[model samples]
Target: MVEVRMRVNGAVRSLEVEPRVSLLDALRDHLGLTGTKKGCNQGACGACTVLVDGERINSCLALAVQYAGREVVTIEGVAADGQAHPLQEAFIRNDGFQCGYCTSGQICSAIGMLAEHRAGVPSAVTEHLAADVELSAAEIRERMSGNLCRCGAYNGIVESIQDVAS
Candidate 1:
């Protein structure tokens, strides 16, 4: 077992976890943060997305020990004082999800995507890499391509992210 310490949902957490344990499993099984789903354990699906130090990652592909001393933010940590994050509100307003299995991951991914864009990260669809990236539909789609919604909610998800971006 490896001892890992990280800040989760604004609290410092220290736990002994297997060196190979995924962050998703640690969050769900050990910390009881079940809001992050596990749709595909192989990381093809972004159902296990979470923020590590403000960047979105496929938690299923990341080891718990790899995030030691970092800030790990799961979907449960996205809200503020019981108020939903703007991206979450946007997702709700835009009806971005169905079946809800992918909602948490989608929202978390959108939040991280927006942050990346704000920091000038270029997406595949970005026309001008040197300039501030605009939140175009194509850009949003490209950035969120890693996340799949089996319910066919792409339009709504794109619209939600666009709404929050604007």
Candidate 2:
């Protein structure tokens, strides 16, 4: 077992886990943070997405020990003082979910994606990689391509992110 220590949901969390334990399992089975779902245990689905040091990643693909000193932000960590993040509010207002199984991952991914865009990181669909990328429909789609909504709520998800970005 490996000893892992990280800040999760604004609290310092320290635990012993198998070296091979995935971050998703550590969070859900160990820490009781079940909001981050397990969809495709593989990286193909975004259901296990979470933020490590403010960047979104597929928790299923990450080892808990690998994130020992990082700040891990799950869906439960997005709110502050019992108030939802603006993106969370926008998702609700835009009806961005159906079954909601993918909502947590989508929201976490959107939060990181917005941060990347704001930092001038270009997406594959950005016409001019050297130019500032605007948060257009195409841009949003490209940025969120990694997240899949089995409920086919792409339109609403995109709208929600766009709303929050604007």
Candidate 3:
């Protein structure tokens, strides 16, 4: 077992985890933060998405020990004082999910996506590398391709992201 310390949802957490333990298991099993779901248990699915130091990553692909001393944010951290984050509220208002299994990951990924856009990070669809990328529906869709909703809620998901981005 290896000791790892990380800031999760604004709280510092320390745990003894096996070297092979993924961050998803560490959060769910060790820290008891089930908000980050486990979908494919591989990098292909975004259901285990979480933010590490403000960047979105698949918790299933990242080992807990690799995240030591990093700042991690799960869906639970997105809200404040029981009030939903704007994206969360937008997801609800726009019906961005169904079955709810992928909602948390979707929201978390969206948060990072927006932050990336805000920082002027360009996507594959981005035109004119020197110019600010437009937050068009296409851009949003391209940037969010990693997170898939099996319920076919892409329309609502795109709408929710557009609502938050606008």
Model 1 bad stretches (over 4 Å): 129-133
Q: State the local distance difference test value for candidate 2.
A: 0.92
Give per-candidate clash totals. Answer: 0, 0, 0
Colliding residue pairs in candidate 2: none
Off by over 4 Å in 3: 128-134
TM of each candidate vs. truth: 0.96, 0.96, 0.95
- Model 3: which residue pairs collide? none
Write candidate 3's Cα lDDT for 37-81 as tens digits.
Answer: 999998887999999999999999998999999999999999998
CA displacement after TM-score superposition, residue 31 of candidate 1 (Å) = 0.3
lDDT of 2 by residue, 1-166 (tens): 8889999988999999999899999999999999999998999989999999989999999999999889999999999988999999998999999999999999999999988887778788766643244588988998898899999999999999889887
lDDT of 3 at 37: 94
- Superposed by TM-score, candidate 3 places the C-alpha of residue 50 at a distance from the truth, in angstroms, of 0.3
